[model samples]
Target: MNYTLHQLEIFRTIAQLQSVTKASEQLFLTQPAVSIQLKNFQDQFNLPLFEVVGRKLYITEFGEEISETAFKILEQVQSIKYKSAIFEGKIAGKLNISIVSTAKYTMPFFLSDFINANETVSLTMNVTNKMAVLRSLENNECDFAMVSTIPKKLKIERIELMKNKLYLIANRDFNSTKKKILLKDLNTNLFIFREPGSATRLAMEQYLIEHRVTIRKKMELTSNEAVKQAIIAGLGISIMPVIGIKNELQNGDLQIIDIKGLPIETNWNLIWLKSKNLSLVAKAFKNHIELKKEAIIQQHFSWFNDSN
Candidate 1:
């Protein structure tokens, strides 16, 4: 009750950096000034916030708990400021979005102009697997989730963003001629795959099963980047989105493995819970996407059509 918001902010910064010196540098204050404020703040608590050990600082258990509380408090304060601005006829707030790893290449293009136009709108984007993206949406933790595999169980509304094509790919050296191979022929090669919960892996599994092709061995990776690296290293061939591998494909480091009935198609969409109310910022983002999605596709994903 006795601590000021300024002190909480200062304490959070110190706890985060673990060093009064670094916190002072980041906050543009003298080290002594930071140390004094830290001392004043620490005087209120019996437990030490952080410790200096051999030139490095460590946050204590209590420090982490208090730091988390301080973060929530700051976030709430930011929401209040944004709410006030909205009442004054402004669209200024946080826009939290979680996207599948492959959507990273696409979402930013859609976000660019909207972000530039609304300088006050803040964006928090998390690029993770489809499982985590859906989990965040299910828990209502984020404003929107950009994913290709739409969930069957969740009650959600979606705006189609772009077509997602997953192609069987490999190191350029592995397919020198890029000759089309039958699905049965691929069973001989080792395959790299995204983790089980990944939508990309699910699509690959469906395609392989539909053709009755079975592999004997596989290596699993957790992200598009890791899977792409494995493929580029010739560790194995795997299905991956073209957007994530454009540079590799363009530079001849990797190549699409030609196969009959290849390039598993999916649609990328920005989905949110149908039951959830959209925030002003979130609504603005949706509106922006609805209005400019076509232009964004033309500018950023023209290669998608060209490749087809």
Candidate 2:
């Protein structure tokens, strides 16, 4: 009660941006106003929260701790607001979601429908690699994370949203005489791989190790799109999610190689830290996914069901 929320908000912004000028712009206040509020906030603590060095701002250890606490407090406050709104028979709040890059193929369509149906709800989506999404879930930075491969080390609750299939893909021009290639045949072919920390890459590697199949040469690409482009350009063949290559496959730009025991099957899981309390919005989104998951798959990815 000693410090106002406005002061904490200003401080948090400054800490995050590391620039008074940028914070002021973000907060839609004058630079002098931001400086005055920051000074007053620091005065309440009776210590320097951040230090200026070489024309750049750096948060002190104490500042970092305070900033983290401020975020938790703000998050709780938002949850309280959401709870109150729900009690009044209104569904409205912000939803923070982190998704692995592979989920980008289908997540947006589902999210779009959710957002459209709930006009008052605000949503933030962070698309990144699997490891980063897991870290965000562990840090309680996001309400939910969508991933293909769940890590055993993290104690989290997960629900299978949909099935993901990884397929071997090559350029249309690549000639192969066999209808069904043996896994060992890939030993002589160059392969394009996803970068480290990618769930797709991990799955592919595990399958190869299990079958004792080894690729002759490999190139690592950072993103699914980049890997797809590399394959299209004849850089090398890659194992990619079927969802990611829908357009390319439809256009005849890429062809799926029918390797025996290919098309690694995995489930797309929606995960959250078991210890974190779920806000109303988070619970609503989870429920929404559970209720509409099958419909979503059938609509956007019907081919998957038909083929299976």
Candidate 3:
């Protein structure tokens, strides 16, 4: 602290604005205080830093050189501070998180593991569809979002958490009649789907469109539980994440059809803003989620094999 960091900060601000008065206004100090600091800086340099000609203040050549060096020194000091924080293992903060509706089952269990290890940190959770999660990231509402669909042109940075697959689910009665069915054959049956902008629903629609299959009639539901209820009630069939329907599928309330190219495989990703400053808590949460996501998925959906 030989050369006060505060002095360099004031000098940099003054250099940027090219006006002592404006810097003082922004820093919440009086004009006289800014002037005194500037005079102190000049005294330390043993020279005049600025030449005030007319109403404008212009920096001298020596002042320009000092300004450049000051910025570099300040940046280095900040880098050291950041590195020191990471080494100190100080994990105590709240992290705001939003995830796709289906992630409610898996993400919480994974986060529970983190909570067990770090008793100091707390989590605030939001379960929403992909579009809302993307909106949360854009608006700085959430520190990170867990989603299957990637948004376009949003400047989001995504890390692949794990591979997740979408499956065609039906009531046990439907499975008893036809253990195996064709995609073209299922076109005549009524379809239950998630609402628009849902990544899983979108993927299912894309697959149907690609295969030239159209449903006889369609019903849109808000939650996976609702969709599963509709299917188990023998109302219609729907496509959803395998992880989301594990319990029912295992309990024989619902079953997956062995159809060729029916279930679509996809990756789950954690996304956040590229420009926002990631807090220490947020960074720690992201690292923990990404590093342990795969194992969590496996633990929850161990019955489902990775093989095609």
Candidate 4:
């Protein structure tokens, strides 16, 4: 019956991380301090929030319900703080953003400009896979999420940021001739693929499926950087976002294969839950992105136009 916002925050962090040790590190508190707060939080409810199994923490059904409520409370509190800051005519608050790993190549530039423009604003950016980003948005854990493919099932609003063009990339030495390849020809080569649940992988799979292309030998990598490296090592070819491979493409370490029906084009979308209240800082960022999207693309992604 008696608990503070701080205790609720601790509980939420522990629940999200599923590890008290990690929660402590994220909160900048000692493990014992985090444990004490969590204990106090659970004592107030007189019920177990989580269970430990084989040294791993799992949230119970009741714990999941409570955690959802805790998130709503925290969001409302933040909304109130943002409203106060608005009345004071100051744009300030923490902006939590979740970005799919592939967007890491371009999102940072926009975020840097936003941060530089608003000195009072703080930021927490979580770079993760597409599924994780969607989950973050669904759980109200982040103010915005940037991804290539927008899920049809989630009740969220999205704005197109730019084009996401994925291309088949191979080691420069693989083919010395500047000859375009056919999509059907790709099945013969080993293909390096992004991990399952990745937007890039999903896009690639959809395209291949539609074209009736099946890769018999494939290597799955968890990160774009790893996939690029693996391709450079001649492990296989991969379909990667052009934004993430611009540097390598320019350096001639990797070459975008001129393939018939290549460069799967998708839009980069900025998404947020429709029901969640946006903080002042979050609103500012949304505006900033809209206003500066074209200029940002021109500055950092001009190559896109030239390549296309």
- Best candidate according to TM-score: 1
Rank all candidate structures by their TM-score, best first, as comma-separated numbers: 1, 2, 4, 3
Error of 4 at 299 (Å): 2.0
For model 4, residues 1-308, the per-residue Cα lDDT tens digits are: 98999998999998899999999999999999999999889888867899999999999989989988899999898878767766778897899999999889878988888898776687899999999999999988999999988888899888798888988889988763747677677778898888888998998888789888888898899999999999988998988888888778888999878877778988889999999899878888899988998899899888786787
Backbone clashes in model 1, listed as residue pairs: none
User: Which residue runs does candidate 1 get wrong by more than 4 Å?
Assistant: 1-48, 54-56, 61-69, 176-178
Tell me the spans in candidate 3 whose CA falls farther than 4 Å from its real position: 1-89, 175-179, 294-301, 305-308
Please give, for residues 23-135, the per-residue lDDT of candidate 2 as tens digits: 99998999999999888888888667999999999999999999998888877877787777777787789899999998998789778788898766779999999989988
Give one clash count per candidate, in the order shown. Answer: 0, 0, 0, 0
Error of 2 at 157 (Å): 2.0
TM-score of each: 0.84, 0.72, 0.67, 0.72
For candidate 4, what is the lDDT? 0.87
User: What RMSD does each model have against the real structure?
Assistant: 3.8, 5.6, 14.5, 6.0
Assess each prediction's global lDDT (C-alpha) against the native.
0.87, 0.86, 0.81, 0.87
Worst-scoring 10-residue span by lDDT in model 2: 299-308
